[model samples]
Structures are given as structure tokens and as C-alpha cells.
Target: MSALLQLSKLIDALSERIGRWASWLVLAAVLISAINAVVRKAFNVSSNAYLEIQWYLFAAMFLLAAGYTMLRQEHVKIDVILHRFTKRTQIKIEIFGIVAFLFPLVLVVIDLSWPLVVKAWLTGEMSSNAGGLIRWPVYAMLPIGFALLGLQGISELIKRVAFLKGLIDDPTEKKLAKTAEEELAEAIRAAAEGAKK
Candidate 1:
């Protein structure tokens, strides 16, 4: 029980950190794109460098945001049917789907991506695009993302196991799904802060 709580806390901290960093990356990408557009249109100066940077930034944002998205239970689910099931049934389904399907997929992604990243590193792979920015560093995000995802999946699986054992109550699905009110409130708060700044 204590171990599960400790792991949950760690995962939460990691998710928050990743989410913040991903947000910053996205903001940077937006700023860079805006600058590129202005420079090209106003100054008649374009940059292949800026275009390449956009793709790399987008790739990093996608990969780095994945684990945090999963942690928040924001991933799409076909829960139209699953929502009607009993708690015990839900647990069984999670054990089968997650243990048999989800975790294995994460492991396979991590396993395959590691070698791909290593080869990219060894060969010093670069974009074929002329005047492109650094590419090998972008390739490295694949393994790093999957590795973090795999770790978080393991942590979630352990928590599920503990729930099965009655060590902890399953986290309520209702609370997991944020209501529209919550979303609106968050948006309003953000807008207010932005206005102040």
C-alpha cells in the first residue's frame, strides 16, 4: 500500500513536470513559427532552418506529451460499453487488456526504439533536407519517450494490481473524467491570469 502510494506520487510528479515542459516546447514552437512567418513576409528573408526546427519541435512535443497524457487518463477510449460494467468486471477487463495488450505494446515500442535510436546516433543520421537543422537529436526523442511511457505503464499496472488485492480502492472513473464545468473553470482561471500579466 505504501509502495503503491509512493509510486503514484512519483508518477504524478513526473507527469506534472513533463506536462509543464511540453507546454513550454509548444509555446516555443508557436513563437518560432510566428517569427518565421514575419521574417519571410515582412523582411523577405526565409529560413529552411526555421522550417526544420518546427518539425523537430513538433516531434519532441508529441513524444514528450504522451506519458503525461496517459497519466491524466485523457487518452481516447471506447468506453460506451465498458462504463456499464461492474467494478469487478472492469478490473478483469483492465487486467486482461492492460496486462496482455497495453504493457506489451509499450515494452515492444521501447525495445524497438532503443536500437533505432542507437543506429541513428552511431551513423550520425541527418535530414536529407538541404540547410536542415540537427536531426539526430530529434530521432533520440523516440526512445526517450517510449522509455518514460513504459515506466509509467509499469507504475499504473502495479497500482491496478494493488487495487485488485483490495489494498486500495480503485480511483473513481467519474472523477477521472473531468466535467465541462471543471474545464470551463480552468479556462477562465487561465484567461484571468493572462489578462493580469
Candidate 2:
């Protein structure tokens, strides 16, 4: 159990780091987009490569951060029904969903995508667009993203099992500090109460 928990922690840490780093790609994409626009408008110069690179960066950010999103429990959920359930029940449901849905879905995607990635790499596939980038790097993101998501799913399963066994706190509990929106709402409520007082 301890070993499993340690492995979970390691996977969580890796997902966190990858997410943080991948997030920067958003900024990079935006900057490149701005530069591309400026160059096209101001200098009457443009390159499909620049536009394609921006697209690549956006794809990379979304794909690479998927596992990180899951690790942080930020993925979309139907909370209306889920929140009504007991914590243990909720964890059990999650385990079932992970095993029954998530794992199979990711495995199918990875199985389907690996050959495309390999073919692209072997063929050195480049974009059909003139001055555009290679195809394999983007093709590779599919398998990489799904694999990371799968690993994170396993980590989440371990944590839930540990919680049920009295080895850890509620894994679904939000442990991070409040978001800026939450903090702002709290401040507004406090101010309103103070005015009434």
C-alpha cells in the first residue's frame, strides 16, 4: 500500500511538472501569433511556417496538460448528481468509471494513434502546406497525451483505494488554495457585511 501511494505521488508530481511547463506553450503560441500578424500586416510578409507553428504550440499545450488537468481534479464532471453521494460512494463510482470507461477509452486511442505516429516518424511526413512544419511531432502528441492521461488515471485510482483503506485523507478534497475568483467573492461578501454592520 505504501509503495502504491509512493508511486501515486510520483505520478502526480510528474503530471504537475508537465502541466506547468506545457502551460507556458500557451504564452509562446500567443506571442508567435502576434508576431505573425504584425509581420503580415506591417511588412506585407508572411510564412505558413509561423502560422503552423502557432497551431502546433496550441495543440501541444492542450495535449500535454490533459493529465495535469486530471491530476488536479479539474476535469469536467456532472457534480449535480455526484455531490449528492457519500465520499466513499463517490470514490467507488470514480474507481468504476476509471476502470470501465477511462482506461479502455485511452487504451483504444493510444492503440489507434501509435501506428500513425510511427508512420509519420518513419516517413518524415511534412505538412502539405508550403513552409509548414513536420507532421510527426503533432502526430506524436496523440499517444503521448493519452499515455499521460492513462498514467494519471492509475494514480487517481491508487489514491482512492488508499483513502478507502484509511491510508490517506479524502482524495477528492480540494487541498489547493482558493482561486482568485473565490477570493474576490469572499472579499465582496465581507465588504457588504461590514457596510450593514
Candidate 3:
């Protein structure tokens, strides 16, 4: 139990760092797209690299951010019916879902994607578009994304088990509301800081 908690913490910390980097990737992608549009419209010249860059950035952003999302418990759950259940029942369902569904799926994806990415790299796969930039890094995103997601799924399973064993209280009831409020406050603070700047 203690070992699982420690491993979960370490993974959470790593996910946080990855999530931050992913956020930067998203920001860079937006800026690049904007610049690309302007260049094409104003200067009547566009680089072939920008299209590939967008896909790479978007892929990295989604893949790297997945673990963070899982850690934050922000992933979608079809819980319209589950919400009416008792806490113990909810925990049981969660445990079942994690063990039976999530873990196996993640493991399969990570296992399959690893070889797929390696093959892409070995073959030097590129965009099918003629004279377009070939981005090998984007090919790497598949295994990396699923790998991080698998780590996160492990952490989540541990957490769910802990909750079921009565080691920790379940926070599902108010977790979303609290998270949303916190996010709103953060946005407000950022807006104020930008205004001051």
C-alpha cells in the first residue's frame, strides 16, 4: 500500500512536469498556426513545414497531457447513473472499471504502439504530401502517449483500491465542483496579473 502510494506520487510529479511542457506545446502550436495564416495571407508565401508542425504539436499536447488529466480526475466518466449509487457501490464500480477495462486497454495500446513507432522511425515514414516536411518526432507520440497513460492508469487503480479499502475517503461528490471553482479562481488571478502587466 505504502509502496503503491509512493509510486503514485512519483508518477504524479512526473505527469505534472509533462503536463506543463504539453501546455507550452499547445501555446506554441497556436502561435505557429496564427503566424502561418498571416504569412500565407499577407506575404503570399507559406512554409510546407507549418502543416507538419501543427500535427506534431497537437499530438504531443494531447498525448503528454493525458496523464495529467487522469491524475486530476478530469477524464470523462459516464456516471449519470452511477452518481445515484452509494459510496461503497461507486468504489466497487470504479475498481471494476479500472481493473477490467482501463488497465488492460492501456497495456495493449502501449505494447502495440511501441513497435509501431519504431517501425515508422526505421522506415523513415513521412507525410504523403509531396515536398512536405517529414516529422519523425510525431511518429514517436503514439507509444509515448499510451505509455504515460498506462502509468497514470496504474496510479488511478491504486487510488481507487485505497478508497475501496477505506484507507482514504472518496471525494467524487464535490471533486468536480471544487476543481472547477479553483480553475475559475486561477483564471481570474491570471487575468488580473495580465492587466497589471
Candidate 4:
């Protein structure tokens, strides 16, 4: 159990690091899009490669951040009814969902996509669009992203089981940290109160 917990921590750390790095891709994509637009509009020059690279960056960010999202417990869930359940029941349901649904789904995606990734790489597949980027890098993200998601799912399962066995605290509890927007709003409120005083 201790070893399993350590494995869980490692997976969590990996997901966290990947997610943080992938987030930079969002800014990169935005900058690329802006530059593309500017070059197109101002210079009347455009390249399919630039446009395609933007899409690739977007896909990379979305796919790569999935495991991180799961690690952070930010994935979508219907908590309206779920919140009514006891903590143990909730954990049981999550375990069932991860084992029965999430794992299978990710496995199927990786299985289906692996061949495509390999084919793209072997063939050196290029985009059909003129001056477009190679296709394999984008194709590879499918399997890599899902594998990360699957690993995180396993880590989450281990944590949930550990919690049930009294080996750890509740794994589902949200960390009590303020978002940037929240912190800004709080600062504004404090400034306003100070002015009134």
C-alpha cells in the first residue's frame, strides 16, 4: 500500500508538470494566431503552415492538459446529485467509474490511435494543405495524451482506495487556494473598504 501510494504521488507529479508546461502552449497558440492574423491583414501574406501550427498547438494544449485536469479534479461532473451521497459512497462510485468507464475509454482510444500515429511517422505524412506542417507530431499527441489520462486515472484509483482503507485523507477535497481573479477581487474589496473607513 505504501509503495502504491508512492506510485500515485509520482503519477500526480508527472501530470502536474506536464499540465504546467502544456499551459504555455495556450499562450504560444494565441501569439501565433495574432501574428498570423497580423501578417495576413497587414502584409497580405499568409502561410498554411502558420495556420496549421496554431491548430496543432491548440490540440496539444487541450490533449496534453487532460491528465492535469484530472489530477486537479477539474473535470466535468454532475455534482448536483452526487453531493447528496456519503463520502464513502461517492468514493465507491468514483472507483467504479474510473475502472468501468474511464480506463476502458482511454485504452480504446490509445489502441485505435497508436497505429495511426505510427503510420503517420513512418510515412512522414504531410498536411494536404499547401505549405502545411507534418502530421505525425499532431497524430502522436492522441496516444500520449490518453496514456497520461489513463495513468492519472490509475493514480486516482489508488488514492481513493487508500482513503477508504484509512491510509490517507479525502482525495476529492478541493485545495483551498484563491484564483488570480479571486485574489484581485478580494484586493479591490479591501481597497474599497479602506476608502470608506
lDDT of 1 by residue, 1-197 (tens): 78777887698679658865676676678889999999999999986889988888898888887777667666677878987998877777876876788778877877877787788779877777777765668877887777667666666676677787888777424345554346545756897899999
Q: Pick the candidate with the highest TM-score.
A: 4
Q: Cα miss at 26, model 2 (Å)? A: 0.9
Ranking by TM-score: 4, 2, 3, 1
Taking the tens digit of each residue's C-alpha lDDT, what string does model 4 give over 93-170?
A: 999999999999999999999999999989999999999899999999999999999999999999999999999999
Instruction: State the lDDT at 180 in candidate 1.
Output: 36
Stretches of candidate 4 off by over 4 Å are 178-197
Worst 10 residues of 2 by lDDT: 179-188
Between candidates 3 and 4, the one scoring higher on lDDT is 4
RMSD to truth, every model: 3.8, 8.1, 3.6, 6.5
**Candidate 2 overall lDDT versus native:** 0.89
TM-score of 3: 0.83
Candidate 2 clash pair list: none
TM-score of every candidate? 0.82, 0.88, 0.83, 0.89
Task: Kindly indicate the candidate among 1 and 3 with the higher TM-score.
Answer: 3
lDDT of each: 0.74, 0.89, 0.78, 0.91
Residue-wise C-alpha lDDT for candidate 3, range 52-159, written one tens digit per residue: 889888999898788878777788899899989988898789878878997788778878777767777788877777656654678678778878888887877777
